[model samples]
Target: MGGQQPAEPATEELTIDQLAAKVGMTVRNVRAYAGRGLIPPPRLAGRTGYYGADHVARLTLVRELLDKGYTLAAVERMMSELPDGALALGVFETLVSPWTPTEPEVITEQQLAERAGIPHNPETIAKLVELGIAERQDDGRLRIPNPDLLRTGLEVIKLGVPLDAIFEMLPKLLDHADAVAKIYVELFRSTVWRQFADAGLPAEGWPEIQRTLEGIIPLAGQALVAAFREAMGREIEAVAYEELGVAPDTLPSTG
Candidate 1:
């Protein structure tokens, strides 16, 4: 008897329907991706085509890239350049996934007025628009891009701070914040990210890079808060000494 032919390596095979369901894509889109050469053509068993784990992984990666604001063409180019492996998928996923998601909450004019504790004064609304605190929608509703910031503004208003004075100071505050943000971003890009890029971003280095980025998110916030508190305390103390004729050092220690 002829020697038994070598057995084919066991692999999970999924039909088009199964593949689409597994990757959360429509069968039509999967077929279209194959046609566009974004994904590998399925293995053919006579008239039927079967997808494997690689196909599922590629589809999932494509979906993630699209979700992260990459255009289809850009995604295709990226997919083409990436080596065929799970590591490449992981790298792109980590790099492209949003650090934080900001979904704008829509509120009606009446709701916004209630939140801000202000009447529907056109002059006040105009000032808010100019200050970038809120935006008016075409549908007549208002969009508070950062509700937390709006709430803070309202609190300041409640404290009897004139709206005009607050608006006048906002530009300077934003300018300083922007400068600080630029410095931090440039520092990361020049030092950490540049070193990684220069070293060719080896596959083994991805975890460390990811961890560094994740750690920076919270650390950066804490550093900014601490620095702001220290600076504000000094300024407050100086103002009190000059205007109120009271030295901060002589005041009872809160601690």
Candidate 2:
């Protein structure tokens, strides 16, 4: 008789809730993806279904691709071609998860009005939505995507800046920021990421690449602040000396 085959390793199984939590997605989204065939159907045991490591890895890959601007159809096509073991949830977690100082906060319309120091006016809420500063949910609660920015805007309003002026200037500020972001992203892609890709993107260097990307976040913020200050200083000096009729030599040193 042939020797009994070695027992296969036991695989860890996760319930639907566990799978959703592990992948940072909602249970509804998990079901939607499964229904759309973007993910493999979970194994059934009795009345319940169970997911495994492959499901987690696939979900992470899907999220990463979507975050990179791929459409759902494109994501489905790409996911179909990925060979088994091509993705690891652990690696993708470190690489794709955002490192941010702020988390989204949900507030009722009344609470939002109190925060903004305004009456419960639909026009004001509409303006906030138009600026992409807040979103209105089906439940009628407002979602502030970044509390820091909301606080900053509220402070500006407290400083007696006209709300209309503030809203008008915000779009211009966003436009400039978008351009600056593109420049830095392109710089990184053309330099560090390009070299890594040229090297065939070795798995060994992935951690280093992730660290480098994380390190650049704060550095980029500092650089932007420094540059903005310098430009503002130059503009103030120009307006003081030329437009305001003040002598350049009489100007106070910004240093």
Best by lDDT: 2
Query: Mind sharing the TM-score for model 1?
Result: 0.66
lDDT of 2 by residue, 98-146 (tens): 5442879998878877877877888888999988899999998999988
**Model 2: runs farther than 4 Å from truth?**
1-55, 64-70, 73-101
* TM-score versus the correct structure, for each prediction: 0.66, 0.72
Q: Residue 249 deviation, candidate 1, in Å?
A: 2.4
lDDT of 1 by residue, 79-173 (tens): 77544546557655554444333566788877777866777777877777788777999998878776767777889988989878888888998
- Model 2, position 98: C-alpha lDDT score: 53
Extract clashing residue pairs from model 2: none
Q: In candidate 1, which residue ranges exceed 4 Å CA deviation?
A: 1-102, 252-255
Clash totals in order:
0, 0
Report, for every candidate in turn, its global Cα lDDT versus the true structure: 0.79, 0.80
